[model samples]
Target: MSKFILNKILPLFFLAFILLCFNCDGRDSIKKNHTQVLEENNLIQEFSEQVTYIPETNLETVTDTLLSSGYKIHIKTYFNMDSSVLKTRHQDSLNLKSYYRNGLADVIISTDDNVLFSKTITKTFIRENLSKPIEGLKSFILKSIWIDENTALNGTVIAIQMEYCIPETQDCLTFKLSVKTSGEYQLKQL
Candidate 1:
């Protein structure tokens, strides 16, 4: 009678232990799924905050017009659905020159793993020595007059020119910069 009772009680105890393990496993799986979802949401929120939302403009007409005007383009950067600079590959480059004179910031479109595209940027400091300011120039503004996206079938390109200037002294300096969009938007020392 004692042997029969022991056999029955041991089996019942083993069954209960197995059920508890299954329950614990199910709960752990749910917890893991919940944690993954939270992480994704946080990433999305961070991306939204860093990116500027711009509707995709038709580059067809703009390309034809630029081409007919005898202008050639070689796009240096490519645009994508992900417009967040924080999540882009060029985050380090973007953060480096994000700010300029008078508290101006950059608008970048990263292309490759280490490439960035900025529509316009101001030249305030001397390139030879960033600590020193440009002589007689309070601000040298460079603008993107036209973007020729169709120039490269497989890729996109842009042409940015520095046609404007703001001189601090009476003497005026006139210069223009025309370079295709590429790796990093860096201004050559003038």
Candidate 2:
């Protein structure tokens, strides 16, 4: 009701969520049909954190959240991919390849009716952490987002971690973002 439900602030993760959907061809796939479609469109992948598939739209919402130190942290992600990239089951018949992947991450930090932080971070957020900028128009996956209480070891109010992946070469990088109660945050390449 607060608007963030679908399009408002309540929206965008994985510390980890393995999607296992029917592959139409009788094989099992880690990605749902709708997820594949969104990636192909090179658009924002729509879905909720729910792992269940919606036959009608093949989408749910892809988001993760946690309550910590009086602040609520929500991490939402949208996957992106290049249409040219073709996906095929590996010999294992499970893992995906060429599987171009990219994503948009929305991190929302709030308390009660007041919002302290909201950011839609892209690969750029972890740019400095990458060995080199991936060249050409390719796909990247906002692999995962999670709350890391271990950050308490660092004395921060809250710590969030996100992983960016490039399925083409099976490369992924995890980055950590921490915010103070004041709503300030910085991305650190973990």
Candidate 3:
């Protein structure tokens, strides 16, 4: 009787161990499959579609509404004093040139590497002889008033403020311009 009982218990224990091992393996496989499914579906790509570009016509309406809502659009452009070439450090200043001149800037809108709509703004700029142009200029600064996301179009509407300054003159120019960028802009993500 004792021998027979020992035999039964040993087989039961061995069977239980094998079953647990198989169960754990099955769970791991399920987890892997779930991960693969998620990767295939790619949440980032899905989220990209939800973001839409504001049409050019809509942008005008939006800008008008924003202007009426007491939102002042300020842009500053820093030139090389004489040349339209942008300063390396102040490259962002040129984003609104079209807007300041025509009240709009043409922008390429993309969603997750997908190009949506390309449009321009109506911001315009007029610069006089603010300073003498310099040659072989090294660097400059362009700063503009901050505009929130809602007031501007879906893309980035950068306000250019400063022009590149030469080492000798240390003078720069500012122009008010608006740049319109759409679809997956860094500002939109933030």
Q: Which stretches of candidate 3 lie over 4 Å from their true place?
A: 1-5, 26-190
Tens digits of per-residue lDDT for model 3, 21-75? 8787655456565436556668533432232111213222232113332233433
Report each candidate's C-alpha RMSD, comma-separated, in the order given.
Answer: 15.3, 25.0, 19.1
Tens-digit lDDT string for candidate 2 (1-190):
6565556443331212222232244454435685575566674323322121112231224554545355666666654433223444544323433334355667788877777778887765566445545453244556567777676345446777877665546776777777787777766666
Select the stronger candidate by TM-score from 2 and 3.
Answer: 2
Cα lDDT tens digits for candidate 1, 55-107: 24312112222244233433232222332122122452232212112212233
- C-alpha positional error of residue 159 in candidate 1 after TM-score superposition, expressed in Å: 3.3
Question: What is the lDDT, from 0 to 100, of the residue 2 in candidate 1?
Answer: 83
- Per-residue lDDT of 123 in model 3: 18
Ranking by TM-score: 2, 1, 3
Model 2 segments more than 4 A misplaced: 1-68, 81-99, 128-140, 152-156, 168-170
How well does model 2 score by local distance difference test?
Answer: 0.57
- Model 2 / residue 32 / CA error / Å: 41
- By TM-score, who's the top model here? 2
Q: How far out, in Å, is residue 177 in model 2?
A: 0.7
